[model samples]
Target: MKARFEELDFQQTPMGELMLRRRTEVGTGTDIYEVKLGEEFLMSSLFTVAEEQMATLGLAAAAGDELDVLVGGLGLGYTAVTALGDPRVRSLEVIDALGVVIGWHQRKLLPVSPALVEDPRTRLRRDDFFAVVRQAPAADAPRYDVILLDVDHSPRHTLAPSHADLYTAPGLTALAEHLNDGGVFTLWSDDAPDEDFHATLASVFADTQAHVVDFDNHLTGGTSSNTVYVGIRQ
Candidate 1:
């Protein structure tokens, strides 16, 4: 049997101290992969229902057979891999601010890294998602059919102060500008449904909704829920 706990990789990133670790549960004997940013827990392979759902729900609402998708975060490669699973997606670009995070995938350090790196439709770009959307797209830029954002914890709870603006009305409007007609915007939030954020999405998009996704929590012995907010541009 493998060791009880093993640190896979560690790096000092601009965002903070990034670390990946694998631990085998004593009872289940399942190896669980986890990511840590500084001292706070960021993501875990054990629970990624909402991250996968962000892509599934977004692409399901998209109105095209061939879709150009944009993913605003690439944590453990769950969201990006899920998006690529759909045959309707023609292209996918994932934007992440931390180069070290991207390096983990490029080096095939994570389980889903192989799928994300081998896919022809996927492009992992090292850049700030908020910064990219905050600026106007170039004249020749192709508008995205669906945009999946899984950066911050929620609209109000952000990893950094700079990310808070993207959850606002003006920031959402800028995000909408990058989408094609009938395009969809999906966001994964750790918080429960936020009425204020829903209202802000409604102000910027033609339609909006908050979907609560439930997943089994091994540690808690009960199911936990995450909110996925969808907005459609007309």
Candidate 2:
């Protein structure tokens, strides 16, 4: 018999209704967690290989012993936790637009929440990632060695309409200002590799590459792919 799912937490944000749920897999008897925004599925514990890879790949491309990282989304805390795993990462600032998502980590509701909260090197900041990137850096602002973003569904598809501009060349240029010299910028997309988005990145950054991350989709019983775009600042 298929195990039943339980709603762990739910909240209403400016974006939409947010919910966190968990269920046990019937065959494996392992808990599967999911986050949803309204009727749209945001993330699932069943497939986190791409999310974890976003951090590992981004950090590897960034050259530095003492690295300061910036993560644009805190979904399930997988990327944030993965970044903290690196001994070279001196600090990680995770920025999320939704406060409820941050609360999920602070309350230790998500599976990766415990590790994220207990890590002193990680700091969760509630702010609009696009706005933060678009604004001029303050005198005390700290430029990151690498900036990993996984907020939008894709460059063409976004959770919010306002996020579409962030994928553009001009918007990407603004975000590049937040990175140090030779810094890396990585973005995770639910869709497959998009050449148009790659062109946009290439126009703004010195070097750009798109990586296809494939993982098993339990729901479909087949392999599914996501794209990770990596750009390096000069």
Candidate 2: segments with Cα more than 4 A from true spot: 1-3
Q: In model 1, what is the error at residue 206, expressed in angstroms?
A: 0.3
lDDT of each residue in 13-82, candidate 2, tens digit only:
9988999999898878899999998998889998999999999999989997999999999999999999
lDDT of 1 by residue, 1-234 (tens): 579999989988877889999998888898889999999999999998999999999999998789999999898999999999999999999999988888889999888999999999989999989999998899998799999999999999999899888888999999899999899999999999999889999999998889999999978999999999999998
For each candidate in turn, the TM-score is: 0.98, 0.97
Q: List the pairs of residues colliding in candidate 2.
A: none
lDDT score for candidate 1 against the true structure: 0.93
lDDT agreement of model 2 with the native: 0.93
lDDT of 1 at 216: 93
Supply the TM-score for candidate 2.
0.97
